[model samples]
Target chain A: MTDITNQSLSEIIDNIKTKRISSTDLTKAYIKNIESAKKLNAFVTTTFDQALDKAKQFDAKPNFDQLLPGIPLAVKDLFCTENTKTTAGSNILNNFIPTYESTVTKNLWDSGSFLLGKLNCDEFAMGSSNETSYFGNVINPVKDQLVPGGSSGGSSSALAADLTPATIGTDTGGSIRQPASFTGTVGLKPTYGLCSRWGIVAFASSLDQAGPMTKTIKDCSIMLEAMSGFDKKDSTSINKKKEQYSKNLKNNIKGLKIGIPKEYRVDNMPKEIDELWKKGKKILKDLGAQLIDISLPHTKYALPTYYIVAPAEASSNLARYDGVRYGYRSKKGKDLIEMYENTRSEGFGDEVKRRILIGTYVLSSGYYDAYYLKAQKVRNLIKKDFDDNFLKVDAILTPSTPSSAFKIGEKTNDPVSMYLNDIFTVPVNLAGLPALSLPAGLDKQGLPLGLQLIGKALDEQKILNIGYAFEKNCAFKNKIKKWW
Target chain B: MSLDKEKIKHVAKLARISVNEAKVDSLTKDLNSIFKFIEQLNELNTDKVEPLTSILNQSLRSRKDEINDGKIREKILKNSPKESEEFFVVPKVVE
Candidate 1:
């Protein structure tokens, strides 16, 4: 066994198809790996028995059409894997299990993808650093000293460590992209509503979307094709016909217009990051991508606008955890009101509490017009800005984060500074566009600086293809060879 | 930008979350700093700008209303400190 962790899902499936590796053997290998490295903390709960059962069911003449048939992949804790504990990194839902499945998780299983386990995330997907997770942070398998960029930190960590080469994660605002940036792997946040939300835990309803994170852009593209589709259960799920994300990978960047937001080159940006981005641009230019300067004039206001909009919606969405519906109730309350208050007070973490208060205050009767409504309007302007630029270029380029992964406990107490970690990636979510992060180059301490590509809605293939071309041209896979 | 002690209490109550009075001073300080930062948005002129809640600028389709029983009663109660069959046992509400 050449460390099956080194093989992609396609290679694994081919072996299983040719009977070179039994599906049972493959399933047992992943399970053994999960049991052996419990310290990685990647999986919150391993679906070992369930995965074995699924592998057996498929062992009798498996479906070859299902690209990932019998291959194990993790699901970020943010998604609802029916009957499995879907804790979104908070004690609030520590015991919460749903009877229904999220469409993406369900679809992943239906595509013959066997479960590896549920990965950890920031509490309620609130933090840019995975440290907010109540289940203890997901250690970067590549470098334990660094903090995994959050909210989907676990997904990226698992893929980078080869816990599983693939996983599904939700990005409300850079949760997926930023983590991928830190882990030096590929993560795609598809066009808004490309994947249904019926089963994923809600963070910011308007901005929440589920996408794939994997070792390579090609894996992301394949997983994305299997994931994106219409689901009536999710009203926001789009009705767009299924399109192969890998279809455009062969397309050259010849005459491709790549828009670079000069505004992202902030004063405090590290010199190494600046150098790496310039190098990434040079690689793209060498392969024929024209780097054009464009302005997202509203860039400065994105963090504030996102803060207002995300928390306001978060305040409403999280209101359901009133101890009546799901989650813990206060043990020492004298009345219903006290019960509600105490239960929530103890259930939610500090960042979650901060967001809920901000959300509620903004949406309350008197302030709704002043705060929530105004933020929504600015969101529209932000999207319009992107819509305007997409007509001029193939995709927008920006830094995935201000810097590479910050050290643990660096800014956890300062919520505002933590929120700034996603500044460059937030606007794309606000615009409901497709975005992908690829390793451009590494920094002085060997951390990666990632280049982000933002495409028009549903044209995920264009950017993924661009990423594939750049990956080959820039030799980022070689850069990443040091990590894996 | 400055949130007073009373207003902080109101915001906390409205959010249906309880914060310890001992910690309120620090939280209030933190909240004030954040609010001051967000107050920068007040500078933008937007007499004509409509607030946008969603990035998807499409109409929400009208669908016939129906009831759904989101089963999780047992799962939801698993976290309760005290519970009985069919309902969450709480302190009686009568005066």
Candidate 2:
């Protein structure tokens, strides 16, 4: 038998359709692979029995119409999977098995995708590194014990390691793209409201968007097409006619205007990242795309604004996780007040608690106007920067992170330094635009460094098309040597 | 705008989270640094900018408010840490 686990998602789907590989056999191979790669800690919960059973179910009666019939894929634990434990990589919800499915996951299953397991992530999608995951840190497949960028770290790790063919991830601030850049996988943080946020565990209501992480851009487009739709359940879900992004991925980039923001040139950035950005611009330029040097003046303040807005929303959203409902509660509480306090104090990790405190402080009476409201207004300015740029350029290109993946415990002690990793990626989230991280080149350490393509809201196809053109031309080779 | 221990404790209290005394000193430091970092936003002059609550500038679509959901009492209560019949159990709120 061929190495089914090594096959790209599209290839796996094709093989299943042609009866060259039965869904059961393919799923069994992945289950074996996932079990052997346990040291990576990519998966928080493995639905092996469920996956095998689902594969068997699909094999019994193959459905040709289903987009991902019998294909095993890992879901970020952030998405609520009914009856399956959806921890969101936090101890607070370690036993939180939802009674309903998140719309994104529902869309995937409706397309005949079988669940391999719930992938690990940062706690409530808070940290830049997966270290904050209550389940423990996800090990990078590229190097032993290196950090897979987060809060969607496991999603990126699994895709890069080929433990699962494809996975879904949510990006609040660089969660999807940074990890993808770190692990040498492709991640797309689609335009806000592109995918419904109906039942995905809310981190930052305004910023969080569910997107796909895959080995190839083509797989990303297909998975994205399957995963997106408007839902009445999510008030923010955009009710626009969906585009066939996969079909519209034009390999030609002739006359496409790509913007290179001057503001992305920060102090003390790795020289390789600058070279990679230059390389990306050159590739687009060679393809007959006009590379314009533009200025997003408000870009410098994006991170600070993101920290304020995300934490504020997160604090509000996470307030529902008190001991009263479905999540964990403290065992040593004397009264309701004490119970609430104890439950949160005990259940949440330090990073999560810190964010909650920051959120509460900002939204509190005295500082609301100065901090929370000011952040919101500044957020508008950030969005306006992109809005103004989009009138001139079709898409914007920049470095995904300042550099490649760092070691597991590199910046864990310093929260501010860890937050700086998001400097390049947060602006897109703040502006509610779709963006993708493409592996452009590798650094001196042989670690994957990536470039981002930011597109106007609902212009996912444009970015995908641009990314496709780059992928075909650049041919960035970053397949990791199997160490496990 | 440096966050001190007292202010951090107050914020924690408002958030309904208990921060241990041992951790308060460090939490104060973390918040102060983060706050100091975000103070850069004050440099930009915004006299008339509106606070952007929603990124997708859309109106909230409303339907006739009615009891269309929540009939599955058993399923909804399935994951409750403490429940009695159909109600979620919590620490006593009233005497």
Candidate 3:
């Protein structure tokens, strides 16, 4: 039989349904690939024993009609997985395990999906690069030493490496889309509250959202449909009915209006990124989609605003890791206060600490109104900018990142430069919008580049449809020539 | 907006995270540079916009206050650093 890992998820599903391949066989194929590609460090922990058992159970009683019956996939380590270690790629949570599974993962398991492992990510989903991971940086599968964008770096890298057909990742700023762009995988950051955040590790609660990362937009649609819904456990979980995104993804682009934001053409943008944007516009135009130039005037403030808002919320959310309950606790503390200080100081990495300090500073008594409140107000304007544009356009298009993936150590020393990696993706989170990044083409170095399709709030179908149409036209080949 | 060493130490205390004495200088420099970058947001005029706490405008959903959940004390304490019976052991506060 053909290499099961090489086929698209949809094809693999069909193969399983037709009895051409057993779920166990497919699971083993992925396990072998994951074992061989250990140098990529995509996985913080692999659940091969559990996965093989699940595959065998599924084989004993096959049910291919379910959404993802026996389909092996991975999840970013941020999600809480019961009976398994669920580190948010931080030493603070190095041995932390949730007694309860995250609602997103529970939804997948309920749909008969199989879990391959917990993929690595940035510590507490803080950094733009996965270097913040206490477990170590997840290398880009496309080329050695290059970062597979983050804080969902491991999810993107694993999918790109074919360790698993699909994976799940969280995006606070650009964790999902940026990494997807970097690794040539499709990642969708669903609308805020679209997927329950109850069991997923919190990072900037308001901006944090869980979404799917897959090799194809169709797989993204299917995964999103299975993973999203209302949950009473989470107050922010949207109460509306789950969208039938996969069913609605007809790839019909005729007469659709796609906005190209003028402010995205920033100064010093790489020439390759500009060319990719133009190529995306041309592809959409060729498919009968009308392209319109638009303006998001508050775009320049987005990154700074995100810096304040995300860290402020993260500081509050992460305050729970104070040497109580679980995770790493410093053993050399004299008392409770010292214990809390020691645990956090030793537990968190540099980037996580910096964000916490910034958060504490912003939310402090004297600076609250000036930084936190002001950032929130600016966030409103940014949301309004998107709301106004969506009135005239079905979706918006922009380059996923300013450029392709860079080396892992390239921007680690400069926090501001590292933060700029999310320049294009932050606004979407600030606006609580659903957006997707799919492979557009490769850059001069043969590294993959992606273009983002942003949709109005809760209107994920429109963006998925547009992406489906564009994917057909672009026919971007993303399979990397394995250097690992 | 330049974060001084004292300011960094104060903020770290407030955050309950320790900053090594040796690392304090570099940490101060990093914070100062990051703050300088973020201060650019002051340029945007935003005197009239309301602070948006949630983009969906969903009101805080409250349910009846009742003990409908919580019984699996064992599962909850599975990861405790030091546990005995149903209690997590921490440095004594009362003493």
Total colliding residue pairs, candidate 2:
0
| TM-score of predicted chain B versus true chain B for each candidate | 0.73, 0.88, 0.88
Q: For candidate 1, what TM-score does chain B get against the true chain B? A: 0.73
- Per-residue lDDT tens digits of candidate 3, residues B9-54? 9999999998899999889888889899889988987898899877
TM-score of chain B of 2: 0.88
Each prediction's TM-score against the native? 0.95, 0.99, 0.99
TM-score of chain A of each: 0.96, 0.99, 0.99
List clashing residue pairs in candidate 1. A102-A199, A376-B51, A376-B52, A377-B51, A377-B52
Over A315-428, each residue of candidate 3 has an lDDT whose tens digit, in order, gives 999999977899999997889999999999999999999999999999999999999999999999999999999999999999999989999799999899999989999999
Q: How high is the lDDT of residue A362 in model 2?
A: 89
Query: Which pairs clash (backbone N, Cα, C closer than 3 Å) in model 3?
Result: none
lDDT of 1 by residue, A1-484 (tens): 7877667665766787787887778888777766666666777888888878887888876887776777777889988877788899988898887766788987887887867789999999988878888898777765665787899988887777767858888999999999999988888899998999998889998899999888777888889988889998888888878886655457476889999887788878888878877887888889888999998888888888888888988999998887775777667688888888998899998888988888887888888877777777787778888888888999887778889887888887787888888888999888889999997777777887688989998888889888988888777652434232
Clashes of each: 5, 0, 0
To one decimal place, how large is model 1's interface RMSD in Å? 2.1
Give the residue spans of candidate 1 off by over 4 A: A478-484, B64-85
lDDT of 1 at A341: 92
- Candidate 3 residue A468 C-alpha distance from true site, Å: 0.8
The 10-residue segment with the lowest total lDDT in model 3 chain A? A475-484
Candidate 1 chain A has its poorest 10 consecutive residues by lDDT at A475-484
